[model samples]
Target: MNKDQVKGVGEQIKGKVNETVGKATNNPGKELKGDLQQAAGKVQKAYGDAKEAAKDNAKHKAP
Candidate 1:
């Protein structure tokens, strides 16, 4: 996977941890922050996926 995909997955994992911890500790702010991080990660991963798809398309289309 590209750096963006890898980083996005990492961020998602980290966010999951934070979200779990926040729930355990009853911190709404932390939980919200984790939710945001997860959304960001998802976006990054999607972008990376699109990038790879475009790269592959270009390679296949080349003469």
Candidate 2:
């Protein structure tokens, strides 16, 4: 996995924790921040996936 993939996964987990904590404590700001972080993580993860696919394709095409 690329750095983005790893970091994205980590951020997703952290976001989940923050979201839960925010909901439990009734903190809207934390909840919003968590939501944003989760979205960012998803994007980063997707980017990493695409990058890996491209790399794999390139390797396979090499003679």
Candidate 3:
């Protein structure tokens, strides 16, 4: 996958770890941060997906 996709997945994994740790430790702040990180990662991954789709579409349309 592209850099964005890789980084996004990485961020999502980290967010999950943080969220789990937050719950285990009873830290609302950490939990919220983790939630935000997951959201950001989702957006980044979506963007990367769109980029890849565009590239594929372009290649298909090219002579």
Candidate 4:
């Protein structure tokens, strides 16, 4: 996977951990931040997926 994909996945995992911790500690702010981070990570991963798909399509179309 590319950097974006890797970073995105990492962020998602980190966010999940933070969310779980926040919930356990009764911290709404931390939970909200984790939710935001997870959302960003999903977007970034989608972008990376699109890039990879485009690259593959281009290769297949090459003469």
Candidate 5:
């Protein structure tokens, strides 16, 4: 996986932990922040996925 993919996954895991902790602690703010972090991580992971797909397509199309 690329840097973005790895980082994204890491962020997602961290976000999930934060969200769970926030929920257990009854902290809405932390929960919201965790949700945002997860969203950002998803976007980053998608971008990395697209990049890898494009690279593969280009390689396959090459002579």
Candidate 6:
């Protein structure tokens, strides 16, 4: 996993916590921020996955 992947996962976990807290406190701002962070994390994870796949393909193609 790249730095983005690690950071993404961390962000996602943080977001989940924030979301739960926001729900408990009835804070829409926190909830929305959490949702955004989760989405960003997903995107970063996807990007890292794609990059890894491409790297693997390149390695296999190299004689």
What TM-score, to 2 decimals, does candidate 5 have? 0.96
Q: What is the C-alpha lDDT of each candidate?
A: 0.90, 0.89, 0.91, 0.90, 0.91, 0.87
Local error of candidate 5 at residue 60 (angstroms): 0.3
Q: Write the per-residue lDDT of candidate 3 for residues 1-63, one digit (tens) a residue.
A: 789998898899989888989999999999988998898999999999999999999999999
For candidate 6, lDDT tens digit of each residue in 1-63? 788788888888988988888899999999988888888888888888888889899999999
Clashes of each: 0, 0, 0, 0, 0, 0
**Candidate 4: residue 7 lDDT (0-100):** 86
Candidate 4 residues lying further than 4 Å off, grouped into runs, are: none
Q: Candidate 2: list runs displaced more than 4 Å.
A: none
| Residue pairs in collision within model 5 | none
Q: How do the residues 1-63 of candidate 4 rate in per-residue lDDT, one tens digit apiece? A: 788899898889888988988999999989988898899899989988988999999999999
Poorest lDDT segment (10 consecutive residues) of candidate 5: 1-10
lDDT of candidate model 4 versus the reference: 0.90
Deviating ranges (above 4 Å) for candidate 1: none
User: Taking the tens digit of each residue's C-alpha lDDT, what string does model 2 give over 1-63?
Assistant: 899899888888888888888999999999988888898888889889999999999999999
TM-score of each: 0.96, 0.94, 0.97, 0.96, 0.96, 0.92
RMSD of 5: 0.6
Which candidate should be chosen as best, given TM-score against the real structure?
A: 3
What's the TM for model 2?
A: 0.94
Model 5: per-residue Cα lDDT over 1-63, one tens digit each = 788898898889888988998999999989988998899999999999998999999999999
lDDT of 3: 0.91
Which run of 10 residues does model 4 get worst, by summed lDDT? Answer: 1-10
Better structure of 1 and 3 per lDDT: 3
Where does candidate 2 have its weakest 10-residue lDDT segment? 9-18
**Candidate 4, residue 63: how far the Cα is off, in Å:** 0.6
